[model samples]
Target: MPQELEIKLTLEPAPADDAYRWLSSLPETSVGPTKRLANTYFDTPDASLNRLKAALRIRKAGDRYIQTLKTQGEFVAGAHRRLEWEWPLPSAVLDRDLLLATSLVDSVSLDELKPVFETNFERRILMLDDGKAVIECAFDRGEIVSGGQSVPLCEVEFELKSGQEDRLLYWASKLGEQVSFFINLISKAEQGYFLAGVHRPASLSAGAEPVSKLFHGLSRLWLTGELPQEYVEAVAELKAKETKTDWRTEIELFERLMAEPSSAKVSDLGKAQLALLRTGVADE
Candidate 1:
């Protein structure tokens, strides 16, 4: 019943300090000290847990450790909404009983479980609220280690604690005015799986063709409220298909609002994008 509603975006062409400062400078934001977190993700022999769209991990926060289970949920309005369960552990070891308590009870077997990958990062957090919306903004910087290979991890996550999804998008649009970022749908767990040569997210398949690939990239910019020329061309192709009722009409409006982000209201495009978050049409 506990769901995590969060959106992640990568800061591009902007220094880490700049992103930090920008979030700090925002109104009604309370800053917290940065904390280094080390997380180890686990899976079973055949990766049955991954197949179930669930990730199990034990996190080390200073002297404290936590075990968490998260399901890869649907994307609504460009934010990932997933069911999550967390418990404080006495140490860094995974608790078998806790794993059995989650929705993944039937799929989890303690004996076969093994460590897959790890994500170690330093997180700087801030709470942003203006009575209407409360967002836990986390700017994480560090690296994800796997198979003797690691990728630098730096991204900001805006998790909607409570309030309308539009409110979270509004603050993101305002943040985009000063910094350049791309919406990233991939979660840390998914990234590690791909990095570990264990699993590939379904989103990567969107790039199999030219048009879908373009649209996939375009979707990543939904929060920025800035429409690129390339994206306009991509949407044109997507709009060409006639697969679902009202889908065409929706894309038409998206095409118009996406044409000029400056003149058009950000909320309009945001709403349009959210409408298409789950494409109603498939190419003929």
Candidate 2:
């Protein structure tokens, strides 16, 4: 059971091209050969795996096919951690014994699984090693196809091979200064699901009603250790508009919590305060 820790950033084609050039110029980066990957996602007709927050896919890299199963894990800011299991395949067929070894075996039948969407992308990888930490940076450019519909994919990812999670954010921020990029909470699988008409992507921006967004944004900032300035302003404006005095106290408590180390566990008081803040958002 390998846990993947990475930060995903969504970029436009022009920005992606600029970022690629910038990354290639860095002396410390070791660039790997570009490879084309074709991935097909599978699920039962009613999408039992999707409902369970699990994903199954087989990726074809040249002449080799690899099968993978990933279960959704915690996501903070742009950092995503997921439990992944992978195996090499002799052909494009699913391995029944391998499927039976996992939790999905009980819930899904191997025969019922079918391809729902496909992602074809060309990936260029770059590596940075500082003795203690190794980060693999990937630039993916391609399209996701499903039901005769397709969406272009242009993004950069920083995957922590062995290092502190903060290092990934540090490099992301450094590169972000040269090129504009936004954190993408949705994964490629989620995007494919949305395009397949299963469900909509989760909202990332604060809308006209800012209370709920403020609370959610603050929660992510506290958990991920990456706070966007817009979220801070939104929280301030929402507090000013409200007459409740307790909301101000709750905001202050959250600010203090945000300043703590990422390894710090949330105290009982903090949990209660968070619950109160969520209740306030719901009441609004």
- The lDDT leader among the candidates is 2
C-alpha TM-scores of all predictions: 0.75, 0.72
In the range 1-284, model 2's lDDT, one tens digit per residue, is: 78999887777788788888897788768888798999999988898888878889999999999999998776543467889999999988877678888898778877899999999999989897756578998999999999999989888989999977767766776676567665555678877887898754333444434443444454445334565554566556656675544556556554554465354233333333334433444245
| Model 1, span 51-158: residue lDDT tens | 888899999988999999999876554567789999999998788887766677776667788899999999989999878989998999898999899988888899
lDDT (Cα atoms) of all candidates against the true structure = 0.71, 0.71
The local distance difference test score of model 1 is: 0.71
Total backbone clashes of candidate 1, pairs 3 or more residues apart or in separate chains = 0
Q: 284, model 1: CA deviation in Å?
A: 21
- Candidate that would win on TM-score: 1
Positional deviation of residue 202's Cα in model 2 after best superposition, in angstroms: 5.8
Candidate 2: misplaced stretches above 4 Å? 201-284
- Extract clashing residue pairs from model 2: none
